[model samples]
Target chain A: MLEPVMFTGGVYKHDLVMELVEDLGGYVLQKNVTQSEVILLLLVPKEDMEALKAIISDLRGELVRAPLAGTEVAVVTPTLAIHHLPHTACDIAEYLRRNGAKSNMIGLARGVGRETAQINEYESMLIDEHDAVVFIFGNFVECIRKKEFLYRNINIPVVVTGGPEIPKEELPYAFEYVPSVGRITHRAKKATELGTLDKIIESVGRALDRTRTDISKDPLTTSPPRVMDAVREQVPEVEYSFSPLPIALNLNGVRIKLPYDKHKDAVRAVKFDEGVTLGEVATIRPSKMKDYILVRILPMSETGFVF
Target chain B: MDPMEVFKVEIAGEEFGAKKYREIIMDILQDLGLIRSIGRLYVYVDVKKPVFAVYGLLRTGIPPLLVRDVADVAQAQGGFQIKVNDEEHMSDLLKVLWAKYGRERVEQPSRDVVVVATDTSPSDLPVADLEAEFRQDLTDALLRIAPEGFRNRRNEMTDKSFFFIAAEDTLKSELISEVKEKIRSMENA
Candidate 1:
């Protein structure tokens, strides 16, 4: 088993930690360097965690378990307008990031008003790219109840957040409902407000857990992090991309930030140690987000074997 | 503590929304510094009808901001030299000086000193109308305070008070009268 963990420390000698994880058959998911400090998201072997810990401690770094490390979550709001942004949506996205989830904030084009609110096909497809989605709603129960049609078409688990307290059954379309985090004009500062943010994180954690459980039933031919590592090593041009994380990981796939038309052939030819080309084991398609390439690894049920 | 003398929010069938809207209105009004100018505020929200209305009584009689209040005016050799103490309104003062004594006549030798070649003292000139500005800001705050879904709006302003209403659907005369009646009852209650 591989354990997902995060390393935060000085940029100096961070390469040693990455080398040690590679030597232990683990994969480095992401490396983000901000000035002198660096943050590395890694999937290390469970039994060899101690060896990596020794290297991290020697390098004077902090290591913590990041259960949601490999997955991307979408923090969706009704609209990008000032009414729903910069406060409720931003705080929820920031809170999810602190818990080690790569969160993307998505504001719908015409997602305002209870009667006039809507989610188009393209928006639904983009949200489906993530492992889980958190829909931020407002205070009124009637509005909350009326807004169920927004997420009814979404395949991923939807975690709804609002102001008033409504029963779980009241939101049948939602995987979970977290209350007390409605629209606000100010940043979340008070302890009670922070507690609501914590609730959102916990709810997202549960939703991701449910997805992980379902994925475990029929494992993928190869893990997303392994594919990320293989692609990074073989497709060197991906490094030149301006994206911070050139490759974004999902529960079942990874999104390569490189342009699809130019680099599709190079990414498909990525070979694994098991002598399997990525094109044979995964489906490479144009991503709904930008012009990047998306790779969804086939499950063992289809491939008839796991690496 | 409440900033206004009487601040009441009523949202039928949703007590939690009423409470939250109260905070939202207070926050926006206080942010724009319009809370002190409003003596009484009554907010009536009918989620079933889906209309938001706000009625406020202004304190009234706020004197206009004059050039003398923001600067020191004295007669100089050519015309007049004004030394601005409140640099916040220096731009408005300069605009007023330019309008009064053409841009060519008003010379700024330093950051805070403006010389206007005019015999008439610019001290009595009005730099900004505080009441008018207050009304504009209050209207903005009301637009923000109302729900994002409420697109159609009606703003009624007088010398001493203002009545603002917002609705999702097309607002009619009957709807305005109904909302006004609701706000009046809220004020009485």
Candidate 2:
């Protein structure tokens, strides 16, 4: 079993932690450097966790278990307007990031008003790519209930967040409902407000966990991180993309931040040590998000093998 | 404790909406720094009809800013030299001076010093109409306070009060009268 963890410490000697993870046959998912500090997201072997912890202690670093690591979550709002952004949506997105999930904030084009709100096909498809999605709604129960069409078509687990506490039966399509995180004009600072943010993180964790359990029943031919690593090595041009993270990971696949038409062949041509090409095991297609390529690995039932 | 003398919000059939809108209104008004200017406020929102209305009784008497209020006027060698104490009103003061006297008659020697060529003291000149600025800000706050989907809006501002209504559908005369009647009923209740 692989354990997902995050390491936070100074830039000085942070490479040692990376080297230790590499030596332990673990994958370094992400590395972020902010001024003189560094944060590393890793998946370490469960047995060797103690050894890594010892080294982390010696380096005066902090380590925490990140449950939502390797999963991509979408923090969706009605629109990018001031009424829905920079406070509630941003806070939820940042909180998900802190828990080690790669969160993308999506604002619908015509998603506003109680009766006139809508979610188009492209937006729904983009949100469906993530492992889980959190739909941020407003204070009114009527509006919250009326906006079900936005997430009803989504296949992944939908976590709905709003101001009031409504019965779960009211939103039968939602995976979970988190309250007290409605629209806000200011940053979340007070204890009650911060507590609400924590609840959102916990709800997201649960939603991702449910998806992980379902994926476990019929595992994919290969893990997404392994595919991400192989694609990064073989498709070196992906690094030139201006996106902060060229290759974003999900539970079952990776999103290659390159134009689909030009790079689809290169992404499919990525080969593993078993001499099997990625094209044979996964479907490479154009992503709804921009012109990027989305790779979804096939399950073992279809591939007749597991890597 | 609430800052305003009377604050009330009514949402038909939505107790939760009523409570949450109160907080949202307070937060938006406080953010714009218009809480102190409102003596009483009544908000009524009907999700079914999907209309939002706010009636506010403004605090009377916001004196306009004058040159003597923002600066010290003194007799100088060439003319009257005014040393600006509040730099925020400097542009307005300069415009007022240039309108009373020509541009050539006004000389800004330094960042905070303005010299007028005329012998008459320009101390009593009105630099800015603060009440107008407040009214503009209040209108902006009302627009923001309304739900984002309310495209049709109408605002009526008087000397000591204001009424604002917004809705998603086209705002008609009948709808405006209905909203005004609802707000008036809330004020009475």
Candidate 3:
């Protein structure tokens, strides 16, 4: 088992952690540097956790389990207007990021109102790309229950949040219904409010776990992190992409931030240790999020082998 | 410990919605500084019909802000010297003075001090109409308090009270009367 963890330490000697992870046959999924501090998201071998812990302790760094790391979760709202933004949507997205998930905030253009709420084909397609999606709804129970169509066609797990608690049976389409987080004008400072945010993070974690279980049955030919590493080594130009994180990991795939048309051939031509090209093991296509390239690794059933 | 004399929110069949909207309304009104101006506030939301309404009685008679209210008007040689106490309305005061006494006559030597070259006292000059400003802010707060989807709106503002209604669908006379009757009953209760 590979344990997903986040390492927070000073910029000095952060390369040691990355080197250790690589030496242990683990993948350093992401490296973020903010001024003098550096944050690394790594998938380390569960048995070799103590070795990493010793080095982190020696460096006076902090290590915590980031369950949602390596997965992209969408923080969706009805709209980006004053009704849903800067409060519920922003708070949930920030909370997800704190838990180590690369959360994306998506505001539906026409998703509003009790009777007039809608999610267009393009909006649902965008949300479907994420591993899990949390839909932020308002206080009204009827509106919450009526907005089920928004996620009805979504292939990924849906975690619906609202003010009132409705029975799980009422929202059969949603994977989970997290209640008590609705519309508000202020930041989440109160204990109960922060508790709700924690609950959302927990729900998203569970949703991601469910997707992981589904993927485990028909496992991908290669793990997303391995593919990410291979692609980073082969397609060095991906580092030049203006996206803060050049490659974003999803449950079944990784979203390369470079333009699809420009980088598709270079990405497809990437080589692996088993003498197989990336084009043979994964489907490279245009991502719904921006013009980035989405690489969904083919399952073992299709590839007839696993690295 | 409510700020207003009577503050009530009623949402049919949605107790949580009622409580949450109460906070939302208070937060928005307080943000816009319209809380103290409202004496009594009643909010009704029927999500089934999906209509939202706010009826509030405002504190009467907020006189216009005069130059003297925001500044100290002193008798100075060749002009009446004004020392601004509140810089928030300094620009408004400057505009009012410049419009009345041409820009050449209004000499702002310092940031907070203004000298108006006029024979009459500049103390009584209106710096801002508080009543109009309050109404404008109150209207803005009401629009924010209502749900974003509630595009169709009706606002009836009088000298002492204001009644605002918003809905996703068209605002018809029958719905208006029905909401008025409901608010009136809440008032009587």
Top-scoring candidate (DockQ): 3
Model 3 over residues A117-218: C-alpha lDDT tens digits? Answer: 888898989999999999999998889888899899999999999999899999999989999898989999999999999999998999898888988999
Q: Whole-model lDDT for model 1 versus the true structure? A: 0.91
Superposed model 1: Cα runs more than 4 Å off: none
Q: What is candidate 2's DockQ?
A: 0.79
**lDDT (10s digit) by residue, model 2, range B1-189:** 789999999998888878878888898888888999999999989998899999999997999988999999999987999999989989899989989999998999899999999888888888999999999899989988899999998899999999999999999999999888888888778
What's the lDDT for candidate 2? Answer: 0.92
lDDT of 1 at A157: 97
Candidate 2 clashes between residue pairs 3 or more apart in a chain or in different chains: none
TM-scores, chain A, per candidate: 0.97, 0.97, 0.98
lDDT tens string, model 1, B1-189? 996789888888898888888888887888898888889998888887788898999999989999899999999998999999999999999888888789999999999999999878889999999988988898888888888878999899999889998888899999999888888777777
The weakest ten consecutive residues by lDDT in model 2 chain B span: B12-21
Predicted structure 2, TM vs. truth = 0.97
- B36-142 per-residue lDDT for model 3 (tens digits): 88999999889889899999999978889898899999989999999999899999999999999999999999999999899999999899998999999999999
To one decimal place, how large is model 2's interface RMSD in Å? Answer: 1.1
List the pairs of residues colliding in candidate 1.
Answer: none
The full ranking of all candidates by DockQ, starting with the best, is 3, 2, 1
Q: After superposition, how far is residue A85 of candidate 3 from its true place, in Å?
A: 1.5
